[model samples]
Target: MSDLTRRAVIGASATGLAATVVAVGPPATAAPAPAAAVQPVTRGAALYRRGRFAKRRTRAFWVAGPGVRLSMKLVAVTDLSSGGARGSLRSFELTFRARRRGPEQGTYTVSRSQFAATSLFLVPTDASRRTYRAVVNNR
Candidate 1:
C-alpha cells in the first residue's frame, strides 16, 4: 500500500480502538443499601396503672415550623370511664427549643373515641413546671 494510504488507515484504526475502549469501560458501582426502619416505642399497658388491656403502640410526630421544632413524647395513655363506656386517652408532652424565642415545655392530653381525637395544651407558670395535665375527649 502507498505510504499516505497506510498512514490514513492506521490513524482510523487508532481512533476506532480508542472509541471501543471507552465503550467497553467498567460500569459504576451500585448504590448503597437503604437504612433500616426505626422501631416504634411501645409502653405496655401495665404502666398506665389502670384497667387491663393489650399492648399499645405509642408514636410521636415531630412538627417543624418557621423557626422552631417541637419534640412531642407520648408518655402515657389512660382509659377514662364515664358512665359505662370506656374511652382511649393519650397524654403527650412537648419540649420546644426556639431559635430566637425562649425554651418552653408543655403537656397535652389527647383522647380518641370511635374515630375522633382532640388535644388540650397546658403550660406551667409556677414551680410545678415538672408535670402538667390535659384532658382529651372523643367527639
Candidate 2:
C-alpha cells in the first residue's frame, strides 16, 4: 500500500481505538450510605388498655423534715381523651413532685408547664409534722 494510504489507515484506527476506550470505560459508582438506627415500640392491648400508662411516665416524690426544698418536672403533655378537635390537648395533667426535703423552715417555687402557665408556692404548714401546702395559681 502507498505510504499516504497507510498513514491515513493508521490515523483512522487510532481514532476508532480512542472512541472504543471511551465507550468501554467503567462508570462511576456511588458509595452506599450508612443505615439509620431504629428503636422498637411497645404495642398490643398494653397500648390500648394501659392507655396513658403505656405512653406516659409516672414519677413520685416524698418530702420529710421542717425546712425542705422540692421541685417538680413537667415531662410531656398528652391528650387524655381522643376524638376531639385536632391540636387540642385536653384532659392533660401536669406531672411533678416536690424533691425530698428534710426538716427546715424554707420556701421553694414550682415551675409550671408552658401550656398551663401555673405558679405553685410551697410553704410548710406544720413545723412538727414537716407538712407543706402547695398553693397553685393558674395564669
Candidate 3:
C-alpha cells in the first residue's frame, strides 16, 4: 500500500480495535452515591425518633393488613429516653388506639401520610382490646 494509505489504514484499525476492546471490556466501577442519595433507615433505634412520633400525637396512622387497612389514632408518646443528652432519645413508647380489634400480637405494616410504611410489632394493652402499644427501645 502507499505510505499515506498505509498510515490511514493503521489509524483506522487502531481506532476500531480500541472501540471493540471498550465494548467487550469488564464492567466499570459505579460512582459512589451522593450525599443527598442517602438511604432511608429501615430498621433500628435510629428509625424511631421520639420527636417524629411525639409531634404527630393525636394524628391518625393506617395499619396495613392483607386485604384491609385499619385506622388507628396516635394517642400518646411516652419518652423513656435514657437521659443521656438534652434531646437524645434512647428509648420510647408509642400508644395507638384503634376503633376495632386487630391481630393479637405481631408485626404489621404501619403507615402514615407524612412518611413511608414501617413494620411495627403491636400488642393489645387493655382489657377492652382497643388500645395497642409498640415500644422502640434503643438502649
Candidate 4:
C-alpha cells in the first residue's frame, strides 16, 4: 500500500531468503574436486619401454573407438634400436594379436595397466593372423 509498508515487506522477504540459504549450509563435501584430469601418455618409447612389456609378455591392450571395443594381447615386444651416427639407440616394436582381422590402419586409443591411455598409430601387418604392430622410434 504505502512506500514504508512496501519497504518493510521487501526487507522481511530478503531476510527470510537469507535465513533459508544459511540454514541449508554449504554442501556436505566440496563436490569431490571434480576429477584429476588424466593426461594421455604420448611418448610411445618412454611409456612402452621394452624392458617393461618384454617381462610381462602377456599385456592386454584395450582399443577404444567408434563401434570398436577390442582387447588385443601383447604377443611380442621387440627392441629394434640400432647404433646411429652419434651412437644413439632408441627404437622398439610392439606386436598385438586380435581375434578378428579388422580395425585396419588408423590411430586408436590403446590402454593398459602399465601406463595411461595413449594414441598409437597401428598398422595391420598380417590380416590372416589378426596381428597388429606399432613401432616406437624416438630420436
For 9-92, candidate 3 gives per-residue lDDT tens digits of 999999999999999998889999886454333575545788878778999999865454789998988864344344446567
Candidate No. with top TM-score: 3
- Candidate 2 steric clashes: 9
lDDT tens per residue, model 2, 28-111 = 797655443221222333222223321434432332222433443333334433343333322233333333433343333332
- Per-residue C-alpha lDDT of model 4 across residues 1-139, encoded as one tens digit per residue: 6567888999999999999999999877645433333323466455655565566567777976656679998898776535423322345777888887658687777887766777777888974747988876665
Q: How accurate locally, in lDDT, is each candidate? A: 0.38, 0.38, 0.76, 0.71
Tell me the number of clashing residue pairs for each predicted model.
Answer: 0, 9, 0, 0
Task: Supply candidate 3's per-residue lDDT for 112.
Answer: 89
Top candidate when judged by lDDT against the true structure: 3
Candidate 1: the clashing residue pairs are none
RMSD of each: 14.4, 17.6, 10.9, 9.4
In angstroms, how far off is 66's CA in candidate 1? 8.8
State the lDDT of candidate 1 residue by residue for 1-139, as single tens digits. Answer: 6467888999999999999989989788977655432222324433332221122224342322234344433344444334423544332222222123322433332323231232234443335343333333323
Residue 2 local lDDT, model 3: 47
